[model samples]
Target: TILGLWSLASMSFGVFMGRYVNTEYMQSYWRIRAAGSGLSGVDAAASEVASLGDEAAIISFTEGTIVDDRRTIGYVAKGTIYCVAPVMRRAMPSAPVEFWAAGVGCCERRSNFDCGSARLPGGSLTALTYTAEGDKYFAEAVKEAASVYSITVGKRAQRVFFEGDPAVFIDDLWREAVVAAILAAVFHFCTCIIVSTALQKAGVRWVGGARGLLPGDELAAEDMLLRGGAARGKDKSSTHDHLRNVLDPRASWVEEKPERSCLGCGPRHYWVFHSLEEQHVEEIEKQIWFSESRTLDQGCDPSFFDRVVIAEDGGFNEVATLMKSINWYRYFSAFLTVGMIVYNICYILKSDAHMITSDDAGGHMYLISETVIKPPLDFVLRMLHIEGTGRFNANVVVPIMEIACLLLVLVWVTVLAVEAALVEPRSRRRWKNLSRVLFNFPPAIAGFSSMSLLHYVNPSVLIEHIVEYSHRRASLEPVLAWTKFVVLRLLCLVIGVDAFLMKFRMTAQYINQEDIDMRCVCQLAGFILQLIGIVPVSIIVRERLLRAFFGGEDASEDIEEKAKEMTYHALLCREMYRHSQSDLDFVVMVLSFNDVDFQGLMLNMNSSKMGPRTSLEVKGNAQVTKKNSVEGRKSLEEDLENDFLEVARAASISKARRGARPGATTRKPREGRAGGGSPPSPICP
Candidate 1:
């Protein structure tokens, strides 16, 4: 596919060059240098360049890549900068080469004189193909595309310039080669590619790109990449936005992994979320499961749960600390919410007098009792039948109503503030914790506050939090979200009518209808954006909100399921090693996995930890058995007595023999083969 794409792009470039292309543009560019070419040596070129000025003559290729965006060559020589082929301002920088300032060019255009240094005496373009392949394949390409040039520049300087683009036959091969390939790809695999990418982002395991299958260790564990059996190699600072890459003890640079031949290999291996074949599906499931386990290890490895009892004991305080640590953003949210409520109230108060007429008859305030107060006021007005009458004591009544509303906002904000402060310990510096809360007050005063509560939390922070609580404690979403939405609802109400009371200033009388409409749209837009964003983010975060809220063994089961899925999600999202050691045994012990289906996997990890009963308990038991073996001790004593008696008898016999044969010559040493036979056996009962 990559080759096809490259070929297609190459062909597109070819078609662009053929038939309709203006090679004259390049030639003309060279023609501009014609003014300087007439001069001889460095000084002459310099003088001519000065005379021509900067626009016509090339000054610097500091910005040009060796192979420029237009696939034209550029370089810096002495104090001169040259654009060998000058045109195609819209082109992108080509792939780089070891030599030259700008990287090498990609599109093969007959540049009149792109490589001024390499041009020959005759003003002609020269194509240089320098590859270890010895240019055998491209030799013909060179002959047809361009001629070779060898230009020499003396230390004394020289003025050699190209005149203009030369005439040439248009090449249309790019149509059949490039167009066909590109169209075929777009027609056949465009949707597939997009879908695959989307699924990959959603934590689905897939294999392609002509790479080998399941190359473990090549990828970081978090990515859940699989290595091709012992084969082809492969595979952030911000805490909120980054994946937990540091969790793995063993990490290696992905570049270090040996590249695998995906298409060139004997057979390609792949793992898909849902394979066409059931066997493939199962294999992918295993890979997914394996990857998932490693991903989980990034945070709470199963080891924590394996020793659940111990962890529970040690972790109690940590939990308290984590939950108690105020999000800080929440405080800001409350502050903003209260301020919004206050602003709304003030707008109502200021508008209380009534609508003023040019005729000088006092009237009811404009936009004063629209959304919240309209229903109650309308009823009273209807009963009094003074709906269209001039202003009454509404000025006096409205301030009291504003006070009530202000009081409610104050109470709500105060309660939230107290709870947050109480739960949060004041271990950190007062000022440091207050920084986020202190958020640009001047800016807020100048209408710089976020329009929505969703904006209050950083996207990264939200994501990290979502992932962090994926399988754990209950979410405080209801508590956290309600106040903000209430603010939303209030704003909506304001917009539903034409109050336009977004940030009511005490001095301001009425909000313009347009301002209200715009603010309302922005709020709606923000909501829509957040909603769309969560679609992808939710896949990655996968918080078990239900399990978090509902505490039970059933919820625990769901949590376990979510944990595995999230682990898999991490594998897909992160670029990590394929094979990381995970305590699958511990997972089996704690998680309610279908043992019948996972028996083999469970056994695999279980076997790794299985050898013998060597725990302290087992050793203590073994020691006790030895101490209680009375019969065995008696037998040991008998055996020792027999050995001693034999030794004593042999010593006595040696003494008797020595006494009888003091003069006897020492006997010749007897020769015997090892294990050939024992001495002649004496029959004994």
Candidate 2:
């Protein structure tokens, strides 16, 4: 119930916030600045700034004397860099520089303030301020910087501004979240429909109140009533006459037409009719009563059965063995995902893990790990003194995306495992609702990666700032590079997992051909995308890493093999036949269910051939037999037309009263009869 509510809430939240975040917040944050507007003039128009919003141009400079001694740098939580420099608007030497100009990424240290030609005209320019009305965090960073420099900034100048726009780096986070929500809804809906249809087909109405009466049982009752009605409608002749007419040679013969058997009835060899002689009717009734009693005692659904066909003496163990192997591989894949999660987390939290925090506040950064442990790539590149070059920007966006992908894969794998193991309708029904929130990952990953790549390659202000920021931090470049490579490899792994699951569905037959085909097409498309965008890149990256680290002679061969393995094509090809065999085995098991003895025989024969994962099938068969045992315990009234115990009780009571009467005539039995009076036993049909 919580999961369902969460699913609904997540979708609603995504759809609502996607447009809200982009239009309301982001739009307010980044807008075109009109030319020739002075900083002082903009400050004077602060009253109208709220109404104007993004439409008002705030990129203006204040003509004032720069006080570099009072400059200080501060950072926001996300590592945004800011500089607060005091500006004296008055020309008098006695005037204090109380007006502080906040500039992003313009001060490397507190003492050096290089914001917008301040030395040229002693005037500082502000592009965008941190003191946007409603956002207090950025203003705090600027305030802290001012405090560090022993300057109390005026209320109007508390805002931090940047010559460059960080909005260029801002991603549409809500849009991706919305897409994920919608995808989850679609998957959930499909799973529910498929599971519901399967339940209905099995004569179990999970959605309705009726539980005991099966479709087959109802049909059998209807057949019995029709036969009884026909018997009552027939004219009755004298027994002797009826027998004589049947024995006569001139009696007409009617050909018996075949009738389709209802569910659980199986096939019948002999046919019965209402128009029959007295003797024949009596004999038929006796046989029918015996058959009904036997059927009920056995707790069988089929009222009648034909000869059982023995299966050909061939081994059906291949599928079982193959499924066993797939299960091992599945577990291995799951382990790999877990390892990836751990590795990713370690990388993210590693000491000296370089993260670009603030884009423009003189390239402020933070070390995730307190100790400075540089990666091999960074260590090698450090000799070049790349800090001043401003070449590569360290970003956490792609890493965040990778984390999302990891979580998706983990959930997908877990759900797949749970679905395979569960047999109970109620348990599965509940799981089905929860699984609807699991969204498809490949498309979502693709969308996010594409956006990330676009940001990485484009030479916008944000990208430039990031590059400069990364260059300053020796370890940041390698970390970001390695993170990208990891993401690619993860994508390849996800495609493999999808292929594995697709095969699993094929074997299970839980879904129909069309659904399978659609899934296959989507998976194929995703695989193709992976090959195009992820695999080749991964191969190249792998090759470079190997060459860089090992410089082995067999690097090319290793790369090729690893690349093939990464896509999981080899695994798919090897297991394809096993999946087919599993389907065949499933068909055999289903067909053998018509004969209980043969079903048990097949189950026993194949039981040893299967591994642990196939135990669910054995468990299912056990549950069916258990259900039959339960069915056999039905109430006495359900099995008999009248209460036989009452009749027996009444007979015994009357006999006792007669024997107890005063002066009752009692005729003793002759020499052969030695027993006292005994009550008749109850006759139950």
Candidate 3:
């Protein structure tokens, strides 16, 4: 969640600041400061000087020529003229109209060229846009609010200003900053709210015990156990009668111990079957009933769920935190855009669309990187390596891969769209719908193309599946979910390489100063944001991944961690799953009501670990195995076949007590088990 906030904050601040300031402002400031030094200082002298009409024009800086893309033939020359005056609709009757009338080429123009902090000389006046040429100026009539002036003091050139009130530039910086803060807040809240829904559905409902279970679930679990009796070769009627007698609440001789205990969600709860293999529904239902009934009789603590970790554990925050690492990639992607933004700002700094310097004309590419983007694209001659100016741009391979990927995506989108427009929801879903996925892809790809800052993101499909459920993972969900961090890691590597090459090239060409400034500004904010938010979230992501994939140094810690996953799935698939909007209900729906067999898959995974066999073996438990039993069935295991199936079935009881371990076949001498009982070795050794 914090990472989500960081992503939004950096983007918001960067965008607003970029919009408010540009090289145009820098160029104007540089010129004026140089002028002010000559007249002693700009303070009293700049305000005292004002030029009206053609008087605003001065001799050319470099013969009045500005470069277009820094090439000689790009544009012809003009003088370096400064226009310091207010914007007006028409020229005054007294002064020359040619210098004031800009031929309507200007209206609400937006570019880096327009931003400036310079104030007009002496009285209030601000410079307006030039029409067709830099020498042509327009002063629109305006009253007081805020004002600006473009004052340039070259070594020999003079300062020119037109007098009137111009007040549009006051306190603009403060406004942009405020908007960025507001946007950050909006983004934070929006992320929190959307992710909350996914969390609510996947909460820690499977923490064994009577917690988070309804009354009916208990009965279903009891039934599940009774059905498992046939696998033991007992007569159905006799097993039913025997199970009934043992389960009776009023029977004095009825065992206080549940007949089944398997590796499950929490500590060895009696009602949860402790078998190595998944049991039938009847056995599962029976355990649920028995656990609930026993919990009721014992008056178990109602306060177990009171702890925040116990109640709100294992939900949105966990999954979303992992997903947030993706933003590191997005951060680098945003960094690449600085190069282009700097290029545009430089364009505004030197000259506009009308004219350019002679020395900088005749170049084919903008920003002086012609060789970077044009060579391989020419189609006439083939070159594998771009050696000169084209070196800065992507090589031939990048575009080829990009095109192939783009075509693949286009085909997917087209097929999905047709399926959506022509078929029913159920039918369309069969072929993989693009509704959730394709919606974000178009914008993401566009951002990739233009190198724009992309902040649009959502939780992955795997996270969605865990929160909801579907038989088939959404078409692209597994890819995104499983590879979330992998992609971020890859992007970080790519950006690092690109940054090195770009810095080397830019430094050599002298075209990288503006780019470096922009990148530095963006990164400074990014680094600060990471310190405040992303760092903590990244730790959380790393911890979760480590705990899940690589167990801590201790061996038992491995089982404990895997147990949580098992328990989650167990609670998810309990028989009465549909009744309470429970975990299993979500899984069933995600599977599209068992169209795909997650049960076998989940069972194989859940029970695969050699789970803790005794109460002592499980962490957070202080005591040994304590099973108060029904006397008659106590010796019942002595009569079984002790085959593979039976061994696994009997393994649950092997760790419970010394009495059950004696008849249990092929038991291993597990050293630390409660009451010194050996755990069952399910496989023959």
Could you tell me the lDDT of residue 348 within candidate 3?
25
What tens digits encode model 3's per-residue C-alpha lDDT throughout 1-685? Answer: 4347756866786676555443324233334333332221121122222333232222111111111111001111242222222222122222211212122221223111111322212323233223222432222211110122222222222222321322222223334445565676687678667666444432312212334233323342354342332112344454434433433222222222322453332222222222111122333344335433333332332111221222133332232222233334433444443443343333322221112232323333333223433553543234544335433333223323334554576576667667655776344252234322322233333223211111111234224334322223323586665466445444434432332233233234443353334445444333233223212332334334434333444312345676654454333332223342444333223222220122222222224235643122231111101111254345323322222234334433544543533443432343664665544333221
Ranking the candidates on TM-score from highest down gives 2, 3, 1
**Model 2, position 674: C-alpha lDDT score:** 39
* Per-model CA lDDT versus the true structure: 0.33, 0.38, 0.32
Worst 10 residues of 3 by lDDT: 66-75
Give the root-mean-square deviation of each candidate in angstroms: 27.9, 28.3, 24.4
The alpha-carbon deviation from the true structure for residue 603 of candidate 2, after best TM-score superposition, in angstroms, is 32
How far residue 99's Cα lies from its native spot in candidate 2, in Å, is 7.8
Against the correct fold, how does model 1 do in TM-score?
0.23
Determine the backbone clash count of candidate 3. 62
- The parts of candidate 3 lying over 4 Å away from their true place are 1-404, 420-685
Candidate 1 lDDT over 550-595, as tens digits, reads 2245445455665543443222211111121233322212121122
Shift of residue 599 alpha carbon in model 3, Å: 13
Stretches of candidate 2 exceeding 4 Å from the true structure? 1-12, 19-25, 29-126, 131-134, 137-148, 163-685
For all candidates, what are the clash counts?
35, 19, 62
Q: Lowest-lDDT window of 10 residues in candidate 2?
A: 204-213
Segments in model 1 whose C-alpha atoms lie over 4 Å from true places: 1-279, 282-372, 378-685
